[model samples]
Target: MKSNFKFFLAILSVVFVFTACNKYEEGPMLSVLTKKARLTGDWKVEKRISASGDVQLFQTNEVLKINKSGSFDIFVADSLTRFGTWAFAKEKEYVYFTYKKEGVDNIDEFKIIRLKNKELWMEDTEGVQFNYVPA
Candidate 1:
């Protein structure tokens, strides 16, 4: 009986550790893949929600490709629209993209809301939320 109680306590502790490790606001509870691995993929915009309660759904040919080597590319209708380098900031709570447009450097920071193997959700500084799915 004592050994059984100890085993139950061990399992409970493991469960607590997993639950406490979730860092995103919208979480998967647990994931075996690393954060980078989950973010590196071809993703298409599924929807966008503005701060004023406006929502837009996308059905166009747009894809965001994130590479494991810290590079990223945005393609529209098979044409490259933007290319940049991406990095995790603030202990992986945020993602920063640095790119150039017409000789002007621009950086966009996104706070990760949820990151899973097939889905990604992020919010910008303006409270606009973007949802992405594997493309």
Candidate 2:
């Protein structure tokens, strides 16, 4: 009877342990990549607005590649160039990122306006708007 109680307790303990464990993980940084993060692949520029508020449609092939490995790339006129490593900027009201190339030591930041199904929109502080669609 005692052996039976011990076996039952052992099974109960196992069940309790399994049920108590949680699968979700919280990021340590304030700039979190939530489950809804959609900027994870290649994209092509469809529209761009300069600081002058002049809209320009993409004439040549301009592409931006966002990688899961914390890197980004730019393709212009069918020529691929390493943009550099990318990371979320400081915890501001909007989502933004800062990136620096291999040769340049300056980090450029852009504020994201929209990031959803097949589209991405961002702008620099100077109000240069950039819109992208899935490539």
Candidate 3:
């Protein structure tokens, strides 16, 4: 009887330890990828708006590549010279980006897609939306 009880206690201890270990390993409590985060890849500019509320649609195609390193290269039409680094901020359901260009800071606003199927939207700080068709 003494030997049997010790064996049972050992098994129970092992089971308790395994359960505690498994509880610690419960994957990520939540997904870190947001709709704004889905904007991680290369994107094309469908429209451009100025700070003065001017809108310009490019006659030629423009592309922007966002890298995991937080750097982006902007391709204006056929030119491939403009590039900059970007910073991200998370506030509630909104994600904001700050682009540093030629020593000037360009702050932009973006809205996170609450739904998984919706296309990601980028906006200026004032909430002007930029529809980025993912490349």
Candidate 3: stretches off by over 4 Å: 1-37, 47-60, 113-118
Candidate 3 on 1-135: residue-level lDDT in tens? 999999999999987876654211222223446533655677775565555668776454777777767777777766775666665555334544566667898755554432122244455556465555555
In model 3, what lDDT does residue 77 have?
A: 68
Best by TM-score: 1
- Order the candidate numbers by TM-score, best to worst: 1, 2, 3
TM-scores for all candidates? 0.93, 0.62, 0.50
Which segments of model 2 are wrong by more than 4 Å?
A: 1-36, 92-102
Q: What is candidate 1's TM-score against the reference?
A: 0.93
Error of 3 at 110 (Å): 3.0
Task: Provide the clash count, candidate 3.
Answer: 2
Predicted candidate 1 versus true structure: per-residue lDDT over 1-135, tens digit per residue? 999999999999999999998899999888889999999999999999998979999997999999999999999999999999999999999999999999999999999999999999999999999999999
Write down the lDDT that model 2 would get.
0.67
Question: Of 1 and 2, which scores higher on lDDT?
Answer: 1
Q: Judged by lDDT against the true structure, how good is candidate 1?
A: 0.96
